[model samples]
Target: MTNLSGLQASRPPEAVYIHIPFCTNKCFYCDFNSYVLKDQPVMDYLRALEQEMELTVRDNPPGVIRSIFVGGGTPTVLKPEEMEYFLKTVRTYFPNWAEDIEFSMEANPGTTDPDKLAVMKAGGVNRVSFGVQAFQNELLSGIGRIHNTDDVYRSLDNARAAGLTNLSIDLMFGLPNQTVDMLGESIKRALALGLPHYSIYSLKVEENTLFHTLFNKNQLPLPTEEDELAMYLLLMSSMEEAGYGQYEISNFAKPGMESRHNITYWRNQDYYGLGAGAHGYARRMRHINVKGVSPYIEATKNGLPRLNAYPVTQEEAMEDFMMVGLRMREGVTGEAFRKQFGRQLEDVFGRPLQKMLSAGLLEHEGGNYRLSRQGILFGNDVFGEFVGVLTEI
Candidate 1:
């Protein structure tokens, strides 16, 4: 196994991300590092993951992990016994978990059971995010999701029954043949559930997914740009009416319910990523693990697979900070920016900041820079400016 004692002694990681890459079936629009189970080596993969953690974490004993996110294939896909073993391995390596660590796991509607959820809770998972893409059965089927609306309800009920109160639901818009009315219905249903947090994302046709193939063949039916924009607006207004705050561009949550683990990423903080296909940023260096299970397992036997690793230049880090920070409603704290990079935020990005301000896309309030409502609508364009600035600098 890889030895991590040196790395751990150098710098302890504040967060950990573990990727579980086995799914019952692949979704049509998904391009994440996951596979449809057709006699996959589940046991072997878990064993390798445990071994990787033992080696990698030896160097960075995870002194006080602030957050731990277990994302898919589908983390809940593992049997209860398997999950116990997986969690046991994690605890064994990361001996020091933060007192208020935000441990989250992604759950599929159909795959989770109360028993498994209880095991996760006992294992220190406090948050559960359900992939409830839509409330309609037809849309679920169209997207190649194995679970139906009933599955969503049942899963939510089970999570609550299992004493999981800090929950989040993921929703999607801009689906094929989706109308504003249908979108409204979905939003209403979601709000009616009184979930603490929600992530509503507009569908993007990514490469290598079923949707992309259909799009290439001119067979995809998607909402018009204007319609999609309308859907977004409706969602925002509906969420506000239902007393949820729009914290991030695509995320809404009640006060104090924002995802701490995700905010760590947006804030550009250091985190450790484990398992196949996981990416991490720590001590100015960024790294990604090997993608495939067998490849990852073999590589980690020697050390962290680390297909790629690079240091983040100060200029690059600043640009990334600005781009990611602007996604939040509260925006980037000018003081935090200055403190982290040892430069005045405005002085560094003076010209572009002024231009964006003049264009009514950005504003400064309480020593922070944030996107205006219009900027939120055209956020991609605003973020593009930072990318251009980064390239030039």
Candidate 2:
């Protein structure tokens, strides 16, 4: 453990994200930094994680961590004792958490147990986000998910019984053979649980995934672009009618129940990412840990884990700020931009901003710039302009 107080006295992060890269099976459309394991060195991974945290805090001890998110290869897959050890390591390094720190962990439907949930809560985890991709059993199997619909309900019940009040469910749309009615039913079933937050992501066929191979071969039956767009609109309208606010492009939440940790990412705030394939940004530097468990564990013995690190340039940071901040419904604040870059937002990317405004993709209101409903639908076009500006400069 390092003297974190002195290290972070000048600059403290508002959030922290830990990645767990081990999962029982990988999903069809998934391309995250995770691995399927037959014989995993779980203990070695935990020790490497501890060493990484020590070195991370020494370099950048985050101040009053407002949110901490443990995501990935099903964080709940760890046995109860291993989970405790992991959580204990977290507390050991960054001891100064915010009074209202939103500690969240991503759990799969069937992996959660009453005892494990209890341990997580006891270890200061207040929120649990279940990766219940869909409510239909057939869809779950098609996506390579081991959990069924019954598992989702039982997991929620167990979480509630464990005294974890804040709950969220992840839902996916535009699946193989999925209808609008089926998507609606999934949302309906999720709402019935009264979860505070819901993450609805459209399926994308990424490289090296089963879905990608099937898609390339024309074997995967996917919805058309129009159908996918319709699904997005339906989800937006339904969530709005159900009293959930579209805080981010893929995230909806009841008032004040947004995933604080995720907000850190969308806001372009600095956080420590500690785990295999995890990414971190702090002191204007971005780093990604090695993706393989064995490699990361072996590298940690040298005190600093094997990581690919780089310093973010001023221009790149501003571009990232716009790219990520615009994802939020509130958009990017002019004041924040100026504060981070010491220049007016207009002066920085004046031409591109004007073009977006002229095209009705962006609107200026309340000293912030946000996307119009049209822009949200065609957000890629709006974001492309910024990317173009970055490339030119």
Error of 1 at 14 (Å): 1.5
For model 1, residues 1-393, the per-residue Cα lDDT tens digits are: 111223322566688899999999999999999987678888788888988888777755666888899998999999999899999988888878878888999999988888999999999889999999988889889999989999999999999998898999999999988888899999999998999999999999999999999999999899999999999999999999989999999999999999998998899878888889999887777888899988988887788777888877777788898899999999998798876776788888888888888999998888888999999998988887787575565
Candidate 1 lDDT score at position 70: 96
Give the poorly placed runs of model 2, Cα more than 4 Å off: 1-10, 388-393
Residue 117, candidate 1: Cα error in Å is 1.3
**Residue-wise C-alpha lDDT for candidate 2, range 241-319, written one tens digit per residue:** 9999999989999999998898888878788888888888877778888888899898888876647888777777778
What is candidate 2's CA lDDT for residue 339?
Answer: 69
Evaluated with lDDT, which candidate comes out highest?
1
Cα-based lDDT at residue 366, candidate 1: 81
How accurate locally, in lDDT, is each candidate? 0.88, 0.87
